[model samples]
Target chain A: MGRTLAEKVWDAHVVRQGEGEPDLLYIDLHLLHEVTSPQAFDGLRLSGRPVRRTDLTLATEDHNVPTTPGPITDPISLTQVHTLRRNCEEFGIRLYPMGDAEQGIVHVVGPQLGLTQPGMTVVCGDSHTSTHGAFGALAFGIGTSEVEHVLATQTLPLKPFRTMAITVDGELADGVSSKDIVLAVIAKIGTGGGQGYVLEFRGSAIRALSMEGRMTVCNMSIEAGARAGMIAPDETTFAYLEGRDHAPRGEDWDAAVASWRELHTDEDAEFDAEVVIDASELTPFVTWGTNPGQGAPLSHSVPDPATMDDTERQSAERALEYMGLVAGTPLRRIAIDTVFVGSCTNGRIEDLRAAAAVVKGRRVADGVRMLVVPGSARVRLQAEAEGLDTVFTEAGAEWRLPGCSMCLAMNPDKLAPGERSASTSNRNFEGRQGKGGRTHLVSPLVAAATAVRGTLSSPSDLEPLEPLVPAADLAHQEA
Target chain B: MDAFTTHTGTGVPLRRSNVDTDQIIPAEYLKRVTKSGFEDGLFAAWRKDETFILNDPTYAAGSILVAGPDFGTGSSREHAVWALMNYGFRVVVSSRFADIFRGNSGKAGLLTAQCSQDDVELLWKLLENEPGTSVTVDLVSRTITAGDVVAAFDVDEYTRWRLLEGLDDISLTLRHEPDITAYEQLRPAWKPVTG
Candidate 1:
């Protein structure tokens, strides 16, 4: 049988494909965070061993970091952050701790530093390690035990997995973004669609998206039930790698690109299974029900339980019960209590600008609370330097420091019980924001419009953004 | 008991994508500490609707799950895998599985198979007409086979051993009790106390 891209990659990295034993595979990068690493580091200390490969390992603090820059006033959070710093110091592992300009969400910092390159195997203790797959690497999250295993051994023994391919074809509509595309896919396939497969996003629509867009799409692959989602390295990939901090500089640049060019699927490559979605038919999507898969086009009505089959009717009914929404109601009319415009999935600078463009001259709804968090400290500084912070504050949105705030309720940021929010994060599961908190998954533009009207809305609902600079001068504008 | 086993490592084919932990096992089901009894909540939202794939007669339940990209995105709920396994899915095949969900699945004895898009498409196409189509998942061979197609797959080693031995995580940890206890007892008195 012809080897698929996954097989080729797996085979190339295999030190030993053992008999009835797991393959001892080499990992190219290992990311660490505060919450999960302290214990692993403790284990290493107890064992009297060094972190096997410090060069391959990197650490950062994000989960417990405060949204405001200062001494973390919260005692518990301060301790966690302090513990991580001490641990890293004792172990000699490089750490980007809280308050450090480089410190931010591990997923966000990885790409900005350009450590996330194509065709590598990346592992982190956090589940969102799937975020790194945007670079076409075989990145995934490891548990504390696995973290220890990787720290001590440097290599992991892994069993091979079945392969899968998801092809998004055609050109997306003008207003549709990567966020909408992934939502549409989850809606089509339902949740749990890709249970034991690794998804390779392919075709015209995927190819046309920018690296940020591809990252957004791949970042949510975990939401779709796949092991990891990836896009092959291409010119866009090479372009994003250039000038990145850890990217090959000067002499090594050409060689790196040449190798990445070979990372594509062979002509006769075969996948174990496949899915094809027509991007042209897709529209800006939003979740009406609780899970990410319980979504419909923004123009569609809330699903009526009476009209649904037995399998979905209860969820529809329960969603209406929890969300305080009525069956047959227009999704456009669904009111929101809060608007959150950040998470590892959508907290990048581009996402903020997209939301800011819609909220620029508008005021948030009378009672709605709007929060915008940058994914990293770097992103936060850039946004502030550009006065996007003022734009957000002027629109009545709270401008906060970078962290994985509200993405999961690990930190102080959380949804009050029973409050409903239009969020840019990937998941909208019951109580995901907090106990009994209702969430609606939306794009940054949709999130911004929702903040303005206090209900779900699309970018088209707002007037076109005024040009910040002349189109002709854009080429000369420093990014 | 005849040492009977007709099962392949093959998993159910679920075509849905973006499956969060709440859908896999709602929070209401997580009130308990035990790992069992979660199958009832696997796709609880969908189960609420009788027409969901889990309830659909044609694809009521199977081992291999074939889905779209981003299979286990969102949250670190281990219940997601427990629910899938409790619901009788031994293997889950997706183009992409969330990193957290994959680790959780391995710990719970559920196989998360990562395949290429092209091969995954072939599997789905091949199985579309025959929902009961049997695909062999050989952990030893690191291969999945259905009809004439054979696709090799990957899983972390520690997880593979635990699953093949039918060892639950607690038991696996208990297997090293001597080592763990010995280390604890050997902690130097000069070491500062900490949790």
Candidate 2:
């Protein structure tokens, strides 16, 4: 059998083969955020080592940064943000501070700036670092010590990960998004299903996705307990990277595409494990339980505990109790107090546009608060330029600045105690949105519909909004 | 990071599976910039209930955590390890650990000793039955002991050696700088430099 795409990337990045030890893996990019880097920088300080490759390291303020787009007011959050800038300055690392045109979630900024590329090993202190793998890079989350390790030396000691081919074939139904496909996959695989595996998402449905949709799928690989998720680079990948600020240019662009074109898995490649799902068969999926794996179709009732396996039954029971729901409850009857459409998972321009498409010329339900946060400042600018912000705000939503808001609840944008939300973010773990808060993970379209009806609803549950104005009209509005 | 040759401390039994780093040190507490004082944040939410092992007076002085499998399951924050260490834990005795958590523990000099479930249950029982009795974890011998129960534990030998010698991985990796430079030289110029 031939080598898998992951194996090929791993082979190329090996700097030193540790015969009796873990191989030394060269890191091509190191993305950092406020939450995990402060301590790692301190580790460098005590060790008396200068940053080995400052050029490869890029820092941004995401977690704990307020989404309000003003001077950070919270003392603790302010300190965290400022400390990152201070550390970046002291260590000679590049930083995209809040309010900077380039500032955004590290994952969002990396790709938007054309910094993420094929066949590179990307490491970040945030789990969503797997988002970079959408470009065919081998990227995964790292701990603070590893952050320091990468800082002092642009390499990490690593053991090989097994490969799993998640082949999603067929066409997605109208209105179903990449988020739903991933949720459906999680529901089948369970929370820890992909443990010790690097998932290679293949087949036609994956290939058909835009770069944004692919990033959404790869972003949540950690939710399935996979170290990383990747899709082989193709025309779509090359088109997405071409002409961007940090992307290859001129003859270099031609040479880069030549190398990236060779990144696909061989026809005879043997996967360690394989799972197959038909994209057309999936419905708009959402998680009723605390974990992302505890998901069901929007049309179905919450799962009966008796329906689950023995081990899963216990967790399902606890999840139901925490979510304040009973078995057999109709998932559509689950009311939400808030709706959040942001995060590295679903805060890109495409996600905002998708949600905006749902909320256009509509009004949010009474007693419901909806927040539409852009994944990055640039995304916000793009959304505003295209009148997505107007569509959202006219529908009673708060169009806020870019940051990881209400996703991990590291910032002030959080669900109050006992408040439930329909969220587009990955991970619905208990207290993920806030203390005593309940989260239902859904796609951007579902999130918008939930905000409109104040219940866990999908687009089909509401009167469809008018289709977007013609291109000429949209352009005229832009002027 | 300290070298973990041997540690003898009372074990605290936390009989919970999939205790994630979010629970270990909630995202709320992660705003703190310092790493050394996270003991206050370790299991901040769980400890509020008097029933948790950390809140139990018997394990108040415990320095070893004997918990159920999948301990430290979520997130890549090293604060979980820092909090455990600051709270006096020098070793974690679990059936298994999340990959990142185990890696973080090794680099932080907090030993993670993998024991079988049956063995872990017996240790939990022993600790609950004999309050304040210490458990001895020997990295050199790769064994954990309590009273009459002795069990062989396992960790990656390379990680074990690094922990035993208190190696700073940054320095260890820098030894390969020449190889890294060679690869960089050969890297196609069209491949955009991350900087």
Winning candidate number (lDDT)? 2
Model 1: fraction of the reference interface contacts it also forms: 0.16
Write one digit per residue (lDDT tens) for candidate 1, span A107-218: 9998898888877788887666878887778877666656776777655666676777889999988668999999987787666675556778888999998887888888
Task: Give TM-scores for every candidate, taking all chains together and pairing residue i with residue i.
Answer: 0.74, 0.95
Worst ten in a row by lDDT for model 2 chain A: A307-316
User: Which residue pairs collide, candidate 2?
Assistant: none
Q: In angstroms, what RMSD does candidate 1 have relative to the true structure?
A: 10.9
* Candidate 2 DockQ vs. native: 0.62
**Second chain TM-score for model 1:** 0.77
Interface DockQ of each model: 0.10, 0.62
For each candidate, how many residue pairs have backbone atoms clashing (under 3 Å)? Answer: 83, 0
Which TM-score value belongs to model 2? 0.95
- lDDT (0 to 1) per candidate: 0.75, 0.88
